[model samples]
Target: MEPALDDIWREVHLDGLKPVLPLFPTDALSEQSDESELLPDYAESDMNSAISALSGRHCVKLENLSISFGSVHKQPSWTMDPTALLDVLRQNPSLKTVTLRLPIPAVTVIEELGDLSRLERLEMRWWKDPGDTGTTGDGTTSMELFPSLRNIRSGKLSTFRRILSYMSTHLITWLKITVSSFSETQELFNMIQPCSALKSIHIMPIVPLAPTISDPLDLTLSFQPILKCKAMENFFIHTLNTVPPSDSDLTSLAVAWPKLSTFTWSSLSRYGPQATLEGLKTLSANCRSLRKLDIPIQVPPELPKQTPHAPFCDGVTVDIRQWRVDDAVDIDRFVGYLAPLAPRDGTPWLRLGNVKAGVWIAVGDRLRQCYD
Candidate 1:
């Protein structure tokens, strides 16, 4: 509709180019081959036309624009030609939010994005390649690409490391990224260690989010670098596999982020060295803003004589079903220490799957009495 409504405020959404089916079957594929046909076909995107339409519309109102060529249902095969939407992007220099579901564009395209100093949010599907950073002979990636970006979502953790290398990103608020390897995650933490203005972070998977790694993920040690972001509010990590944090690890996290509203480690089930009742109590005591806490924890062998605090927030909920409690723990006393799991609506959330449901029922009963 660029022919009719060429205003700066008009939002544009276009379906990107489609992927082509492979001529060769799986059996014909070779691991050693470096053929372009072996690569996933990327959405060339509808930008070819959208760019032509908006090439002359230099309006400051186009704040949100979305262009895609790829889909999760039909995965692509073959490499992408660098982006062709440079002219359209140049015309709308003030675009604040841009979502390009295209493959990694040439850094030249990134460098030439007209004065996007106002760009606040940028989401790219495959901007994961930390492309040719050694473009400068001295191997410095100090390019001022997105100086004013506040929210960014990319496919790779290494890409963020490249972005955050020289960015004075104090205004950054929300960040989402997909990670594939353990070492990549460790290196990503290096970049995130200094940029503390971030509030919410979502660490997702590339596609079909599942447990692909076989090595034991040391979540406790990995969590150390994140503790540097003291302003963290909502944090989530999804790999479906992790080692339960020890009591010390939990305590360190409780002390690190006082404003932690939501914390999640999306694991199917975790075992070994989980937080005890004391660790849960410590978390509730310190993180008064907590609304949701998802972890694997256990009950104490014997109940403490001192009374625990009430639920820190109004509608706090917890899912700690992946746990093993002490056999000698008293149900009556063990129930009181679990006041933090109390939901605001007076009903407890029990996701028990045959791991002592009776004891959990008693725990829920105590939560009701505490919240009431």
Candidate 2:
């Protein structure tokens, strides 16, 4: 062994210099075990780089694939031809899930998605530059791109409607979309008419960060159509407006979706829509199956002088109050009120404070100072 030391060192050095292996090897690397090592993708690479890696491995079956561009937005040089990506997808017939975060070509990409015959789930985020022509006021209206995208951040309401129209026949069970305008809200209601297969719906504002459009979110009217989907089990809506749904609307929700186990509704503006304690009580009484609640509601300033009663339902596991760190008093009130109402076995969490093991007040104080 001492005489062969030079040869052993040469073999070890040579192994390190070998070319990098592709992601999915056709043959087993070792006979003892079949585990594969995690190979890192080049951080700066684009879709073309990915295609090149898998070019010859057409028979490789990927159960799940995720691709995200490292850059925040795509440059002109980085854009990949949409058809080329489709061509790669065609080769992977066994793909069951795909998640993409890239700037894809227009409407043509949506049609090409049909090529993934075995796909059961898809999540995509289209990157855009504020200066891009496609994002201009006139651009989205002229040509509808991202047909599978049900969510809209900023675009003509008509364009969103057209996009939904294209997806009417797809078998989608979960959906999340953003509505920016009141007119768009109406159109969204119309578009949701055909999606009877929906089991969970999450509605978020299109421009939640900077809302350029000002329209009262008519939640009552917008939500009426969603109630028709009897299969619904979970519903969440975030309205960046100043108007909260009224008690009647809350009652209607409880009546419409009695089977809902989780429900969340929030408002972006501080002065805008908030549910009353009465509305919360009504919600608890009606939605018998509700186990989780994330609502922007104002708790009573003082705990009721009367001894608190058990929550209307078996015991709500989650009651998320949208209290921010700016107001310590509001945070105090929310925790003081809900801690007692929570079931002994249930877990309660505050949006801005921690009430676990009776340390919520201290948590609130710390958060308030941090914000200040």
Estimate the TM-score for candidate 1.
0.73
Tens digit per residue, CA lDDT, model 2, 165-271: 34442344676666666555656665665566667777665555444345655676666776777667788777665456666777877787777778877667545
What are the candidates' C-alpha RMSDs?
A: 10.4, 10.0
Q: lDDT of all the models against the reference?
A: 0.62, 0.53
Task: Say which candidate scores most in TM-score.
Answer: 1
Cα displacement (Å) at residue 223, model 2? 2.5
Which residue runs does candidate 1 get wrong by more than 4 Å?
A: 1-4, 17-47, 54-57, 73-75, 128-142, 207-214, 299-310, 321-372
Model 2 misplacement above 4 A: 1-46, 71-78, 127-170, 178-186, 205-214, 300-303, 307-312, 325-340, 344-372
